[model samples]
Target: MLTLWCPSAASMESAKHAPVSPVLPSYEQEQHLHAFHACEQRHEAMARLLVVVWDEPGRCDLRAMTHVVTAHLRRHDTYHSWFEERGGAIVRHVLTDPTVIQMEPRTLGEVRAEDWQRHVMATPHPFAWDCFRFGILQHDRGFTCFASIDHLHADATVIAFLMAEIRSAYRAVLDGEGPLQLGPPGSYLDYCASQRQRAAAMTLADPEVKRWIAFLHRNGGRMPSFALPLGVLEDRYHAEYVHLDILDDAVMDAFESACHAAGARAIGGLLACAALTERGLAGRSRYSVVTPTTTRRSPKAFRTTGWCVGVVPIDFDVQQRAFPELALTAQRNFDERLSLAEVPIELVLELAAGLPTVGSVATGGVMLSFMDVNVPPLSAHIAREWHQANGRVYINQGIAAQVAIWLFRTPRGLSLTAAYPANETARASMHRYVKAFAGACRQAAEALMPTYSDAGREQ
Candidate 1:
């Protein structure tokens, strides 16, 4: 639940008559194109992949489902937009027609859901058309609902917002309530226009730009990469996904307590563990990785469904430091870096010219993403419903040379999902990494439990 505002179909109908306009792409969108073209050179699809899977009790009515999905597509402007070249520049062309909503219906005869999902995920989206594919796979008792949207258009938060909308709309239609009267959705195009203005106002002397330059200089003019060997010499389209239940509620509670006692957010504990694990695995004293931060700076941006995310570089030493101390330090480092999260990576790269570009961008380097469903938007009350529905998100790691880890907390517990190159060497490395990470999590919680308990008693 990244946003509370849900747009209705009628709210966007007025835009159907507006003239088509070309908008400048955001930094994230530009990075996506860079990756996309790199993949094309290798005969692969660049994955801005997002997939959500859930189950419904009985066979869903295709016609009714169609109406609900159409409403969703019309609610968001990105769903009706695509990238195009206009006079030597890449721009997003937003369509004003409300009639064009992309939904590819498919029935699973005997094909596995995972296989079908991966197949659909690997195919490149038509650049001139809507980059969304929604389908239903019917089986005996029920059907699985699958939705995939290109990351260029929607991030995880946007996907969550969309899924919730669909669920509510579908349920209403089934119960004869029809469409809910959701508020008008915010336009991502407007956000992009503001970002362009922000970028225009920035200079090489800006403190944020200087900070980014220093960060890149520390890592040899590029973003830091995974400390350990991934055995990936080049980009490969195939990737393996792993999901593990890292911690149950009790342990997660302890972990949170420990983090709080050590003056750090719960995410700090995970970052500390990541640093230690990399050190132990590769003897690299410093842990460096790129992380995504939400750039929903204003209320309108928060309500808008688009890639409102920015990348930040984090680096810290993990040598001979205890979990709690390291966690605090990691938190401090994260806080300092987050202040500049709004600075576009494209600008950073431009200011720090002549820098080696290999393994520098977030897509080419190591990345860590964490989502706490217990927090706002995706709070436990809503998370409980999603868990009961067996809702899951998937990422297609097409043409990636690095590992990206996603950690999420649901009502059930803390879980880890990772995507890496789908080769034996990389798989083995990721497995080892996950194992070490899990152990680190428990160790951090156990090590700080006594102090946490004592503090609680004093209070």
Candidate 2:
């Protein structure tokens, strides 16, 4: 049976007083602590957006959020990757005194959506090592918990887990429930321990390890000639933000169903569309792309999050593959690499750190991520403007790749967002590419339906 770390009711009740262990950096992180510092130096503004919505304005309490966040930080030390400025290194230290900023409530119409996104992207977390900041965005109707974090220490999963914990603590406080305790716990420290154990048990000569090295080489190979060459690294402007694009529930659900019929995940159909869109620009069916995946296993791992993400590099030739076939091909590529998910990316880069490879960020300028999660501890009684909108918030610092594409499933459905350097790629061209991506996804999904399958069989 699969192991899960869920706590029973009694254990949960007693967990409030449970003592937590001291936090430390993961084994992989300890090995590359200096690299994390270097990354911080390169991108001074590395924070991403995190917004929490609440329904009842009067009932919303910033104090509750503060108590929960501070307490939660102590419970999970991975949340704190404080960079020691004096020593010029990263160290884990749960801040006993974390600054919680509170702002008066404002109206959602205070700024346009694009401007809001731009503002968030430009604002980095004040303390470089601490990673995240907490504040209250007071609105006329309700309040939003506005948080920002350093990408160096956390991923979306980390962000999700943190939010969930904070929400739980906040609820407990509001209900006079007491300090929320985590039961049947699996912390980031545990993840680090597991990774070190796994790494120790394996060797580079192992088939899977060799496959990863080769995969890195494939990504490190020559970059594809895009319809438009991505902006050079030295250019004054690297990338510009494009308006968010969305696919509502009906379209997203239909697309998902289509993918299922073809024995593929939504990602397969997405990759198929992306390749076709590239074909529009390059007039070539051969292409390579990168997809980021989480390595967390079991409910315990999900209970606590950290920088536990890995990437899969895929190369495909769509020159003769039809939409459904291309989708399946993409699915197969992802499945093959799933076995290597547990291998730390740092290990792969260490093996081929400076070697020439297409996977080099400069050579391959495209990156993609897919997310569909609800902020578990977050729900407002009242529906606000953000609630009505079907779009997902997206921000990229151009640290990973020059062109970034993200698809997220919101309450309404799936939303697609794209970004590219304004200097190299025209806004007009980016718009066309985004639409083409949407169109390709729709066409592929339709082609995968059983009716389409029957028609092909009849032929």
The model with the greatest TM-score is 1
Model 1 over residues 25-137: C-alpha lDDT tens digits? Answer: 88777777666766776787555668787877787787678778777877777666667655645666566666654343444456664767565564446353545667667
Candidate 1 deviant stretches above 4 angstroms: 1-20, 86-88, 99-115, 122-126, 235-238, 298-303, 355-363, 448-459
Best by lDDT: 1
Ten-residue stretch with the least lDDT total in model 1: 1-10
What would you estimate as the lDDT of candidate 2? 0.56
Clashes in model 1: which pairs? Answer: none
* C-alpha local distance difference test of each model: 0.72, 0.56
Q: Mind giving the per-residue lDDT tens digits that candidate 2 earns over 1-459?
A: 001112234422333233333444554455335543444677633313343322324435645665565565455546534434346534454433223211222233455547645544544442343344444444566655545554544566654455556656777899898877666446666676677677767766777767776765654443333355554553223456654545655566778777777778888878877888888766866767767777776666666646677667667888967777787888999888776767765555545456665243322346777765533322331112245422123445543334667776656666666666665345666777777777776665554343433332210
